[model samples]
Target chain A: MILDLHNHSIKSDDGRARVESYCQWIRKKEIPIDGFVLTEHRQYDDESDYRALEDEFGLRILKGSEVETEYGHVLVFGVNDDLRAAFDFTRIDLPLATVLEESGRCGAQAVPCHPGRPNVGLCAHYETRGVPEGVEIIEVASGGSRAGEDEAAAALAERHDYAGVGGSDAHIVSHIGRCATRFPREIRDEEDLVAALREGGFEAVRWT
Target chain B: MMVEFGDEFEFQPDVSMPTVKSFTTEATRMDFWRFTDHEKARELGGLPGAIVPGIMSQGILAAAIHRFLPGSTIRKIDTIFRAPLLVDSSPTARGVVTHVDEEEGTAEIDLTLVNEAGETPVLGTAVVEVARAE
Candidate 1:
């Protein structure tokens, strides 16, 4: 199953696209992908229901969150009540160590996103603190990255021997499937996605 | 204050260095690195330079509308931030009258602020109360 693992909707402060608009654009553009995860910045809304849109569009819509930490912006998938309670996702400078460990304990995956970008990327943080513990996955191919940024992220992932995933990191409708992760097996829900990441048989692909 | 349907006007506000700098300071709590840091902005998203706040762009539109209509009062202004407007870059605010209610002295104008890069960083529609012509 191929999924655009990172995306943002109007819920994000900077995101401009509506959830239905993203689905409509994907279908109109003929983006051949299974679905996408709406990784809204700073907060995850468990109450957000997209079952109707998913059914109508034949896409699996999932919810995740992109949060800022001392290490940079991390994309947390399979977020549960425990992870939410353990860390306040609204804080811009959450402790990276605790985030990673707590995410693991909660059976969630916290992957550093756009690891090549400055200020909020892991590469810049690595210069000062090296690698944080339990960072198994990093977003290597980001649709929003400009020029050599993704290459830098790929290099970091390779150097650290970490698994890589791809996401569009789209804030608008047209950018939805520029990059995606292709999983070897079908992923039905957030649990399956976490399990797939743990099982390790996927590759990040540039869709556009 | 008689704005006919299909009438068009353009305005380019001085989004000067001081203006962008001051706006950044005013928006301290909602700070994003891309708005004030040049090198970081380019490094992060390959932006041409530090971007002006989107709200600043919207404010520019409001100012332009007031300038064009003079006695017009903005009843409602809805804006959509399409892209980042780079600091010091010239963006022309264009307004096209779409609907004019003669009895009510109201005009609905389609608005667009196109930057030097030819990108419409802001787009929206505004409803303004035009003064009755003597």
Candidate 2:
């Protein structure tokens, strides 16, 4: 099965598109992908509703949060209440290291979003000491405005021998499913997605 | 006080950050900004003085914006921290309106986090969506 591992819904403060709108567009376009991970900015309070929508539409859905850290946006998967309680993303003051350490504590997977994008990307690691430990995944390709940065991110992932994933980073319906990760195993739930990502059970793929 | 297009707002408020917990994330602590400031802590990765992480200043800037325009969504913020903000002393954050787009209903606000003696440490530019009075 295919999963658009990164995208946002109206739940994200920056997002104005509805999740159902993306679903309808996916159906009409007959997109090869099966579902997407709705990564709202620093919020994941709509998991159950998305799961219900999944059951109704016969498409799988997962939940994640794109956190604005001191450096850039970090995509966090498998977060729980404890993780949410750890940092305030709106503050934009959440240190990257703090989020990684807390992700470890919450048993969540922490991946840097768009490592090559400027300002809000990992390319500016010179400001800090270096890449922090515990980061295992990087978004090599995104459906956002900075597709050019993908090569650098892919290069970073290859050099570090880490897994590279693709996410649309879509705040709108049109960008949905433009980038995704082809998984070796079917991801029926959030746990499976996290496990597949960590075990290298997927490959990043993008359309154009 | 009706805020005009070029009013500079100054606030010398107490700033508190998320208490740095154990390198271990566990329970027990109500302190604002790291319950424990341990020296030689491995989690800190070794640094001089109990300096606040640069990220917290961004939150302080957000708070400043929120106070000025309640219910306004802070769309994006850009901050550059020139020096380490010491955790023990009081630092002030100031904001000024740089531009106003009446058609788009947005305003560009700039912020500066300063030391007690008045040194600009963190500089920020934020775009806030607001409904300005016509």
Candidate 3:
């Protein structure tokens, strides 16, 4: 199963695409993916109901978040009450360890994304502080990354032997499904997504 | 002309309903219902009236900057729209130069558009290339 693991809708401060627009684009383009994840920046709107759109589009739309940390931005899946109570997602200076370890403890996965970009990516932080302790998954292919950024991120993942995933990191509708992750098994929900990341049966893929 | 740090400027553009509708309509091509139809906007959990599109708010900031720095080129402008600016509201676009690189002939400016209620609906940073000395 293939899924665009990172996306942002109008809820994100910088995101321009609407939720329905993304689905419409994906169907129109006939992108060969089962679904895409809505990884909004800073905060997750758990109250957002996409059931009707999902039914109409025949796509799985899961909710996740892209949050800032001292080590840069991390994509978090399977956010729950415990995770929300522990870390305020709005704080840009979240501790890397807490984000990674606490996410794991709360049955979630926090993967550092765009690891090649300057300030926000993990490559710069790794140069200063090596790899943080619970970082097992790295986003190697990001659609929003500039020319050489994705290559650098892939190299970092290779150096650390971390399982890599791909995401569109799409803030706009036209860019959705540009990159994705291919999982060995189907991901029915956020729980399955977390399990897939931890199980190591997924690989980064780019859509042609 | 060398752009200096802490150089500030302000502009109060026309944020009236017709102006907002014209800008919003032209920008979105009338495809975004929330910006064109008040009833659709309200039904979709948006403002009671059409709101100024965020891109238009950015455009307002860009226009303000152009007025302040006449011959300068805006290399990049990254903005975050914090709140919605209603069509009928009045807003003041203000800019402050935060950094200046003489060798590169560039300056970084922080920009904001504050509504009548003193709430900043649009805030951003812009990198502009100052016109060199003749």
Candidate 4:
């Protein structure tokens, strides 16, 4: 199963494209992406919209949020409504380690998003200091704008002994499937997908 | 008052025109990253010398907006990277106020970050909240 595990939609502050628009672009490009995770930033408003797209497009869609942690940005996948409701998006006082621990306990994978960006958020220091136990993937691609950063991220993943994952980190429709990761096993659900990633059953691939 | 759509802005380089060699030298001197080598900058998708940070480009856009539409606080910015900006490149940041909602006290500006080579390194729009002057 190929999955673009990190991405954004109109739900994010920086995103300007709809979920359906991105799905359509994937189909048009003939990219062999089997699933996509809508990891919108700090907002869970797009869950219904993403579900609708999944039903219409027949693709495995995962719902998650990329929260801005004190150390940097972290992806919290597999977060159910109850858990999301309990968490506060504006709280940035928690240490990186505490955030990772909570995310792990919640059964959500705490993958850091775009650690190489110069100054916006997370960097190598946090990644090295507070990496969670099931932290399996490092984002190696984003919207074709930061190929150099992607390469650096890939190197970091290799250095840290983590699996490499790529995503467009796209906020616009044209960028959805620009990058993805192909898994070695068939993932039937969110649990299986997370397991596949944890077991190192994936390879990063770019669409174009 | 807002600057109407289609307004133009320009920023001239310290020197008249730039050659590839000068561009490379200027890009190498930028302190955004620890490395100062042209090849390293190139490897980082920066033009073959000292490339400006994308945030710097955004800063230039912020300056342009402040110049035309004073008292505007940048609420959101979305930028798309198109090409590498060579060092010493004479790039101009331009913007136009596209939409305004009177009740929300917000305006949207279409912005572009372009260089002398006629290449657009980053293009996107920003949403700003304009505060009325006291």
State the weakest 10-residue window (summed lDDT) of model 3 chain A. A169-178
The TM-score values for the models, in the order shown, are 0.67, 0.59, 0.63, 0.61
Residue B15, candidate 3: alpha-carbon lDDT: 72
Clash pairs (backbone) in predicted model 1:
none
Of the candidates shown, which would achieve the greatest DockQ relative to the real structure? 1
Ranking by DockQ: 1, 4, 3, 2
* Predictions in order: lDDT: 0.84, 0.72, 0.83, 0.65
Q: Count the clashes in each prediction.
A: 0, 6, 0, 5
DockQ of each: 0.07, 0.02, 0.04, 0.06
lDDT of 1 by residue, A95-193 (tens): 889889999999999999999887888988997987788899999999877556789999998988999999998865656799999999999999889
Between 1 and 4, whose lDDT is larger?
Answer: 1
lDDT of 1 at A160: 82
Give the per-residue lDDT digits (tens) of candidate 2, residues B19-97.
3342112433333223235354224635334555555668778889888887677888877665566655688878876
**Cα DockQ of the candidate 3 complex:** 0.04
Considering lDDT, where higher is better, how would the candidates rank from best to worst?
Answer: 1, 3, 2, 4
Residue A206 miss distance in model 1 (angstroms): 1.2
User: Which residue pairs does candidate 4 place in steric collision?
Assistant: A72-A122, B27-B49, B27-B50, B28-B49, B28-B50
Model 4 earns a TM-score of 0.61
Off by over 4 Å in 4: A92-94, A121-135, A144-147, B1-121, B125-134
Q: A1-208 in candidate 3: lDDT tens per residue?
A: 9999999987988876678868877887689888999999999889899989989999999999999998999999999999998899999999999999899899999999999887899998987887788889989998767557888998988888988999998765656798999999988899989998889978899863
